[model samples]
Target chain A: MSDFIVGTCLFMCPEKERWMREREGLLHTFEVDEKTKHLKRPKADPSKIVKCFSRPAAGQLMPDTSELRPASVLLSTIRYLFTNVVTRVDYDWVMIYDFVFDRLRAIRQEVVIQRIRGPQSVQILEPIVRFHVYAGQRLCEKNISVFDTKINSQHLLECLKQLLVLYDELEEQSSMCNPNFEENIERLSIGNNRPQMEALYMLLHLGDSSALGRGISLPHKYRGKNVKLAMKISLAWFLKNYVRTLRLIQKLPLLLKFGVLSNLRLLRRDTFQIMSAAYNSKLLTFPGLKLQEILMYRDVEKLSADCKLFNLSFAYENVQFDARKFNKGLLLANPDMYFTVQTLQKYLPIILLQDDDAINDDSSS
Target chain B: MDSYIMQLRRAWLNQDGDVLADLLSLSHNHATNPQLGSDAAMTKAMEHLSAPFDDLVLHHIKVISSLNKDDALTSYAHQSAAIQSLAKILQLQKDENWMLPVMNSMCLDLRRLALKAEASKFGKNQKSGEVLEKCAECLMSCFRVCAADNRNSEDDTKRWGMLALVNQLWKVYFRINKLDLCKPLIRIIESSGLKDQFALAQKITYKFFMGRKAIFDSDYTAADEYLTYAFVRCHKESAKNKRLILTYLVPVKMLLGYMPKKSLLEKYNLLEFWELVEAVKRGNLRSLEEVMNKHEIFFISAGIYLIVEKLKLITYRNLFKKVYLVLNTHQIPVASLLAALEMHGVDDVDMDETECLVANLIYEGKIRGYISHQHKKLVISKQNPFPQLSSLNSN
Candidate 1:
């Protein structure tokens, strides 16, 4: 925590060819700091771009949730999440909060899919995970998932209702940097925080007691002692939703090209701070949350070095190491890969950690 | 009762390590005696030993033993830490820990007896031909011991033995040619209980034939028949075992040069094979290599090799040296080689690389006294492949 220079590479660097030109015919430039390398911020006015940028034709969401009208709302939330949160800030720096929020939004999509359907819903996990997997270039035409069964329409509608409320909270949380944003907006009524919190608690319980739900289990490994897989899953979901919302706002070119807008960076930065505060509250209750903490914690310098090293090992068999170490190192190196690692790391500890404290506590106490 | 077994079978087949570990511990607790428990439970557990599940079972058994001296299984929960401490006590490295014990158990008795007998024969200066015959007999007996263990079904034992031998030969091949190292092995497996005629030997022979022909030219149709028969029987087993089949069956399927039907692949969630191949194509070397090592199925690696070749994901020139190296050392059948080479980067330079590989193989064969180099071509006589060699040279 001292003055340890965290080695890192920012997504924006001077040499990177700016794909889009700004006003005054100037290209967005990333500067190599004395320590950190290649950091570039996206457009300054992300909202202006959001307002102007054209939407894809409505038919494109098909073979997925295209049949549901609420699907468009979720898609809009998705676009908003990317442009507002992810693309707004030059997330090329290893900021802990951005990583948390972005990963949260990605997780939210899974819930959204489930809400749009149900446990018995049409292939929930695949399309949801594939949304990001394809974004990360790890997907191809052959991808398939087993959990794609359809659900009752009523169940789907209920999930969609909850998701819409969650989306409203997310959008408000992400677009807060807009100075025009009032504390109490006339048209938008946010879902009560109590219900949001309650839904989370219920989902966590369902995770523990139910067998058919999202592969959650409370084996003897981490059964008691302190860690709750249910809570961790919920927190992970919340943060992923928040980050995806912010990303949607930032990535939209509508704000950046034309309009006067609030400082998007402030919204991103503040949302992350809020997430960290909430996470810290949970940490007091569950010390074992260190699994996710380690992921959020970054040594920028170490990561930068890891990214380069991992990239090289990609093509050579002589490179010796497991995929996890190489991937962790690569994630560290590339700040832009924050959302990617957070989403992956979210499930791993819950699935893999076999702490004996839970069982031991039962016997001793 | 069958339905109940099916559910337990599902948990086992899922390679649900945690669940299986729990079940194993429960079974051990119910067991009244430790030694009897270990051996008896292992025998009964054959139906539950799918590929990865088998590995987890072995790991759990070791973990249990390391914890309690008197009741490894029953006292599992009590001795988890002590078991971990035992790992340190044994100075067990990750790679060495899981594989070594199983290999040792399978090979130790044979290895020691073989060594002692050879030493005795040499001390009196017995005839060399007599020594060789004695060596062959000893090796055959070793395979039979593996083929006949009462702890598991004969098929499981034989399958276990074939896997052990393949692993052993892979370790040995770097220093010795396959012909020299596995000569006795080839003889034993060819006629031993692992023949296609044997029921338990079905899967073992399928794998044995695949490995045998993997590096040389010969009749693999019979080998394919054995494997296909094994494939039909695979449905009776667990998902973990099905995953195991992909290690070999996938390569065989590819050698047959067609994607397997959806039903077979679905049962195993075997798309990971295609993903690994895609990673290989995209130059994701780490993932590709990890999949090969994790899967530990030579046929899968060979299948990957074929896919890499077919798609031109790799250049033949770059892989020529390694292909040459593998060909020179192993007397795998030509068809197997073509199947293996079919998925690698040998397309544009196919003729040249094939010639180089063939020449290297021929030279090595001549040195091993298995073939003669005449008129700039190799002639096979009294070698491993026998009748298949005449047509192999042209291939």
Candidate 2:
């Protein structure tokens, strides 16, 4: 808090600029805090500008609501597809996912093309987001090791985005119209799984600013215990407090655990990179068991294999961390599962139905 | 009511923005009989004004009459209708900003009435900020017409009005906590060519909000640049405005290693930060937590809680530097640093987590050298190992 410290970054100070110029500081000049700095166009990077701002004008071809398919019919069609395709048979989930995914995409496209923003759009998107998480975990637990299908959780992110847009529009519409606002999810038998969606959002986007904002914006009275825990785990994740992240992930219910499971590669990669520096040595061995435990790998052998994969050395069972030997080329460590094939099979329906006993879980912080 | 119609006709006919602003203002005291909105009276009033503009004038009159009747919901509806007509008229007028004053007034009044209506019992079932959110959409209607009027000559472009609209929209967006929407509008403005040409007041307003947004994005360089512009060039007499700007600027400056003067905080009555500055300098984590909890409402309401939490990294740097200074060696033990943190009340911290902290500091370039795990010590550069955080970004 010294004046010299304050003077060092006093960007607006006339005296500082004059003093720097007098010192002939030509090479390390301060950024010009010109009034027009923001006004000036970005000289090099144009990608920051959104391309969709060039909106189309309304024309006679703009369709009326009467001619389009009702949101109810579209909602039912998606529901039918989900029931018959996704959950009808447990095996071949990988193929069922492709079929259900194609059908769901077309249905959502139909909703967008038809401009559906009623409570029905809410009904349709609520299930679709959950479907992605359930189906994604199912793919992760597949007997085959396909990184491509396992990383297909982007679709869940997309649906979550779609649901956020629908919720905003629905809010505006409810205010625009006085009494008929049915903010209900029960008429069609799909209860508001909004709490589950929030949990998924926190898990999937753990440490993301938008996700963190969603968590912080909610008062404790408004959010459920599940949401509160999800927020805490994500906050720990954000801070790169890997130790706490490891500890908190142990307490999460399985549904929320899928979030940690979703972020496993990132968790492992981050842990290894930091540990390479923290435990950096040519001879000292950071325990392989501790790394396996914190990262939730199935076993230490797999953990050791990943250490080699990331250019770190594994000695016997302990990891020898040399900062120079750490590889920065690979961003993610090898993919690993938190569940065995049998455990995932037993829990697939439970996760899909969101019937994870974790829903009632009130684990202490 | 008769004089109201006369002035409305004159303003609409002559296209006088100032006159129209008063005639449509929410506080303009157009206290007329409620019967003016009845079918027969609306027809009589409509006979005098022209098409399109007639709807605008008539709706404003209806809005005022409803306000007089103490029926805010009805007043808000009529004001919304009035803004809808105003947007059509703004689009209809080609290549002139003579009507911009009215646009500004109507949009501002539209927000006032919306907030008033939201505060009333009629909004009991509505979610907080919904009315204001809808009001932002109404403002967007004007915004689209103005932003899309890019084909006009610079002297006559309605695009000049964009900053004012954007400033209002930013206010509503921040109020409703839908900051995500402000990004596109910011993109349009920053990407637009009319950046410097807006009136000075509007430019100041734009920079002030943009600076706050940058803080949220953690782009401190941009935050410092934009916010310093707003704080310096902001009107000399506007102490309240300067204090508002300082609320954000202080944290950004601190993060960049430029601590604000205590007198400056005292002058602005922002000494809530004085305790924080002291805690950070003394490397007192417990006192830092106490100051934060004592002013928790202030910090959270100002939306700087998370940014303040980020200062903990800086606190750790300061704390470790203290240990290094006392020990006077390049190879200070990690356990010594952990004990220092524990002495300063960093509860539940351990060697591994402390190492994680040290790793983050080095990674962030607060420290020059690296951690030597085999030696159980931090390896220093033997040069300017702990570089001043501010000098790290001067270029």
Q: Against the true structure, whose TM-score is highest? A: 2
Clashing pairs in 2: none
For residue A10, what is the lDDT in candidate 1? 22
lDDT of 2 by residue, B270-320 (tens): 999999999998888989989988997798788887778778878989999
TM-score of each: 0.22, 0.76
In model 1, which runs have C-alpha deviations exceeding 4 angstroms? Answer: A1-365, B1-67, B70-182, B192-197, B201-226, B273-395
Q: Candidate 1 — what's its lDDT? A: 0.33
Native-to-model Cα distance after best TM-score fit, residue A297 in candidate 1, in Å: 60
What RMSD does each model have against the real structure?
Answer: 28.7, 18.2
- Cα TM-score of candidate 2: 0.76
Over the stretch A1-365, how does candidate 2's per-residue lDDT look in tens digits?
12111111111113433344334432111122333235333121111110011122477465333323455655655555554445545446566665567656765655676665546677878767766765655566455453244446777788787776555544444445355434333322333456556676877887766677766665444377777778777877776777777777777777667655778777889878877765566656777776776777767778888998898888877788877788878888776666654555555444554436445333221
Show the lowest summed lDDT stretch of 10 residues, model 2 chain B.
B121-130
Q: Score the docking of each candidate (DockQ).
A: 0.00, 0.13
